[model samples]
Target chain A: GAGVSQTPSNKVTEKGKYVELRCDPISGHTALYWYRQSLGQGPEFLIYFQGTGAADDSGLPNDRFFAVRPEGSVSTLKIQRTERGDSAVYLCASSRTSGIPDTQYFGPGTRLTVL
Target chain B: DQQVKQNSPSLSVQEGRISILNCDYTNSMFDYFLWYKKYPAEGPTFLISISSIKDKNEDGRFTVFLNKSAKHLSLHIVPSQPGDSAVYFCAASAQGSGTYKYIFGTGTRLKVLA
Candidate 1:
């Protein structure tokens, strides 16, 4: 079975630019999550979606960050006015369901560089 | 504040020896703990997990031990192999608290010398 997949394995943008990262969760997975990893740091949770609705977005750093999963399978993470501080790897993950003890399957992260 | 902390940044072990990675958490609400292994330019892969209700969980060469009273956990790999070298992350989640999000530690780099 195919694991989670993220498009644009690498993205470079200038400061103040806008970028969108895409994720394709595993088939039949009802839960999707987004996280960001800074250099030498563990992944920080961003947002999560259960089915088509975002179950939690408290981890989103600021208003510039937003995510959506309209069809319940593919998700998009949008960032506005990119900042150098945002340079890091964005990761996506999915599981069978939400709020359970299910293990999460991760995708190869998309490394985003802000210059 | 970091809810999950992997105090050791890196560790090296000889092949056929035991590799132990430790993690601590400040949030007592965390009831589930998981270990993940990641290679460069790759996403993390689930390794093993232990529930707060159990003191230890073993799977093949990997074993996870939890100390709820100490708010600590350790992952031990017996007869470490060179292929086991990678960054290890410990994540904690409070499933009963209605939060599905996981809090991950900084990560520990483990090097297994053959």
Candidate 2:
């Protein structure tokens, strides 16, 4: 069984640039989530999607960050005018069902470095 | 606001010993707690979880204890193995109004010595 996966395991970009990170959730998963982890810190929630629409986007830091999941199985997180403070590992997770009890399986994060 | 906190940044214990990882939360709304383990360059893996209604939940060698009064939870690994060594994160979630979200701690790195 394939787990949640993120492409471009590592990305390096200059400040003020734009980048898009993609995530492929596990087969049959209906719930998706995005999180970011900084050095020496645990993952911070970014956005959550239930099916094709975003159920929650409160975790997104600011206008520079946006995510979309049109097909319900795949998601893309877009960042505009990247800053040095944005350097971190972006993680994606998915679960079989919706709610608090369902276990969310994670993907190997994509490390983004702002040069 | 950091609702969940793992004050100890790191912990070390020898194999065959009991490893205790502590976590505290400030939000009283949190009713479910979970533990996750992660290695370098990898995403976190779910370990075990306990609900606020129950004080303890055991799974094989792993046990999670929750103290609602103190808003504290601890994960105990009996006879800890080197393979168990990793960064442990504590997560809390509240269920209400049909909305759910998890708050995570800063994480505690554990080292199991052989």
Candidate 3:
């Protein structure tokens, strides 16, 4: 309800296809983040958003991955030319501010499977 | 390169006993550390956090300790319960700015037997 919400809890796509995963942050959260988690591993940062702008995207594996937060509240992660290695649980988290570095609330995550 | 590491992959404790999870890092610029707990198919929830300046921080049943000198940290749960059975992750923030990426450890699954 009030927590971060991710759409398309699961996504299955063929290799080299395109996919988009959506994330709806909490009502007032201004900072949103995207992370990818592989099996038995910790989440790795993919992108960070402060409002409508991406503050850092160094964690993005390649040019195939891109994200946008148009209204600053809801964001979408778009993947192009998806590969099997891209399959993982994509997590979205939101916090009060990127500077706060305090608490972060996460969504259930969208499981992406590539064939 | 993995900056944060949780040497132990899993830990088990009897209910009502104390449970301790350990974590270490290779970075010295990290200013803040936090712990999160995750259950099956669910996102991780924030448990506790401690600043590098402070040696400890406590909240209810959870406590976090930071040792900046040793680049080590720990999460302690007193009177552990079955509900505490989950994967615990340790994370760190480096000055918390710009991208504000918080690197995380592999995670340790803590099983509290009832």
The regions of model 3 sitting more than 4 angstroms off are B96-99
Candidate 2 per-residue lDDT, tens place, B1-114, comes to: 889999999999999999999999998988888999999999999899887779999999999999999999999999899999999999988854344557899999999999
The Cα error of candidate 1 at residue B102, in Å, is 0.8
TM-score (C-alpha) between model 3 and the true structure: 0.97
Which ten contiguous residues of candidate 3 chain A have the minimum total lDDT?
Answer: A96-105
Model 2 residue B101 lDDT? 58
TM-score: the better of candidates 1 and 3: 1
TM-score of chain A of 3: 0.97
Q: Which ten residues in a row have the lowest lDDT in candidate 1 chain B?
A: B94-103
**For each candidate, what is the lDDT?**
0.95, 0.92, 0.92
Clashing pairs in 3: none
> Against the true structure, whose lDDT is highest?
1
As for candidate 2, its clashing pairs are none
**Ranked candidates, highest lDDT first:** 1, 2, 3
- Candidate 1 lDDT over A39-71, as tens digits, reads 999999999999999999999999999999999
List model 3 lDDT by residue over A21-51, tens digit each: 9999999999999999999999999999999
